[model samples]
Target: MVTSEWTGPFDPSSDPEELTHLLSVLSSFLSYRRHAHYNGTHVRRQAFYSLPSSHWSLLSRPPFSVLDHLSHLDDLIDQHAELAEAIFRVGFAFLAPKLDSEWIGEVLGGDARVVVGDELKVYEKIMDRLGVKASKNDVDKARSCIHQFYREWSAEGAVERQKCFDPVIRALEEEFASRARCSPNLNLDRSEMSVLAPGAGLGRLVFDICRAGFTVEGNEISYHELMASSLVLNHTKTAGQYTIAPFALNGSNHLTREDQFRTYQVPDIHPATELASHTLNSRVPAEERMSMATGDFCVLYSQEDSKETFDAVTTVFFIDTAPNMIRYIEAVRNCLKPGGLWINLGPLLWHHAAKPPPSEEDKNKDKEDRTTDANERDIGIADPGSVELTNEEVVALVQHLGFAMEKHETGTFETGYISDPSSMLQSTYRPSFWIARKK
Candidate 1:
């Protein structure tokens, strides 16, 4: 029942108008003192780079780039505001159906041009109710609620949720399509090779990979994600049967059998120290468990695996989340065959700074400092976006891992529908696609 109208024609393809709107909205949002505090402490700083106004007009000229620069500050603000509003609406619909229009408005009410700090406070409260906490009982409860909400949202088949990906996917396709095509060796056609997508949220990208002809095997950390992927794959597989090129594999390619797709159980660990131990014990032995272990891009290559087992490895939006980027990268490198390709999409740097000195309450006679740091705070800790590695540093890190960088490009969507745009933008999480082959 929420009502709002677009003041002008909304075009996802054009960048100038959108960029101007995006800046204006952002400025208004940041004008509030609370918003500035949150941005300084909780949000990443890279999220606020000012786009030149002339850049927007470049689209009308030659060599139209991916993102347009803004002319007016208000224009930029509008773009960001629109995206935030859409996310708030979709998230609310999925997670809080019982909330009436008035309650939703109350939660989201702010300057129409920008989100206020109050809005963020409301979001934090919702997250708390959803059970996003560190305690075992609390986390389990939160996971359950999240799973249920995702299921309900999927069932509703709301177009708004689907629309979110339009911008991101379009940008990705345009930026990476040519580079992905250049490497004929990486082109996966469905002769008989197996491809795996661990942490496959909703399986949207997996579906596209399957269409390119690789038999896909998917794993997820959440049961809800696994279920959603299964349902989508099932439908795609059935539909593909009647197509002109039955086995030719196009955009609709999927596993012919349910058993072909396997979901792995993500280990539950009380502390980071126990994560490695728990994973090792609960799953099959490291040597036999997987052809390759999928983690964040920086760490997708495992150091413990034999040299030539995996053909291809993929990671999406993982690098920013990894706690130990160096170790993780080493792990990924160790797992791959000499010539195997590592496909990565999303931000390279996940900003997180070391926590301040512990208060008296945190220091007890028996509590080990290592134990408290590793278990209590390390797993979910994120660096403020203000702290980040330069793009050069990120590139160097990849090269240091023994990968011959094959491709690198940036992608941005216009529709703001490709993934969680709010989280991506707020976190300064760029979609940086790369293909690296081991030497």
Candidate 2:
């Protein structure tokens, strides 16, 4: 715990110009995903000449504006310790000078003369109310979530995500159907199958299953994503009103048609629409069918009522997020009832230790779970200390846990998110389904 008087080696004094530049850059970055406009464009691009506590409400318009519509500011800031911690850490980063210079440059427009905020003293003073001493790693973790949060839970992002994940979802549903047939209690409510998705970032998949007529509960650890997902899933009365995305689309040739600023409106992801979809269980609203549990995946399901086990477990783009794959598989196995289905979809690459990282740009380009120093961690090895098992190895390990393969496929899919229909990520991963009965 850093005391109030504690100080780090970093200098505190920053140029007024740098502070102004930082404020404008962060404000503009926040604006892009909003419905408002800066100079009549989706994003406010002008630099801020000065920023004082008085202008905060106007500043709040672009950044904290959407948070209000989602999670009321009083509740989010005052109640949730995790969100407050994230804000404090990232807030420090935003104001601190030249920390993670390369990444900050990328986010702040990379102008050589632009001074990056590094004033720890100012940051501490500004962030004193939320007095948590967040380290560099903490700042990186928080920044990644707050910065790119829009892409996962936003209206436009959901539509694109559903399309890209069609295969994985199909596999899970098919296996679920088969399992339902074999169960003695086929008479059970079709939506009552106990489904668990660990590392369920933003609860999109959890709600997706609920819509498909399954009783689902998602587990998420990242407080940042949890805060956003909880508000969107449980609190928001209307969807598409919130903005969860858009930092940059300029100069990227992915746009099919030219616009005033080389940008296209990202598709709207309607969370409400997802709930009311005719295909979803019309009998129960999504909120009634699903819930979110916040905790680490590795230990989340272990302490449940010893008799309680899931009918199926779905992990999409999830398994790889862990430092070690074995613990995740073991945890899934522990949570399963006899002959329960386990569906997995995500790249085999370990979150921290993939060797040489497909490419430098590839690593940084797709910054889903990668830390700021992810590239530096890959010290020129064909394989790093982290587990880099092949899809086949993963399956074999699960089979060793007494699971039998039901269906599987490997392929690459381009999923679009982050504010434009054409803007997408081309990621390759294997999708697998297996029925396991405890031996």
Task: Report, for every candidate in turn, its global Cα lDDT versus the true structure.
Answer: 0.38, 0.50
TM-scores of the models, in the order given:
0.38, 0.56
Predicted structure 2, TM vs. truth: 0.56
| Residue 413 error, candidate 2, Å | 4.7
Candidate 2 local accuracy as lDDT?
0.50
Question: Model 2: per-residue lDDT, tens digit, 1-439?
Answer: 0001112121222545334433433332222222123222322222321456456457557643532323332222222223333333442443555555565435445444445574433333333322333344433444455434455555445555665455556765776667668886755454667788776665667666776777777777654455445545544545444332233323244433222122112113455565566443435555565776655566556444523478788776676675566666777777888777777666655677643436666555545434655543222112223576777888787778667776666654444333444444333333443334444
Span of 10 residues, lowest total lDDT, candidate 2: 1-10
Runs of candidate 1 with Cα error greater than 4 angstroms are 1-191, 227-307, 348-388, 411-430
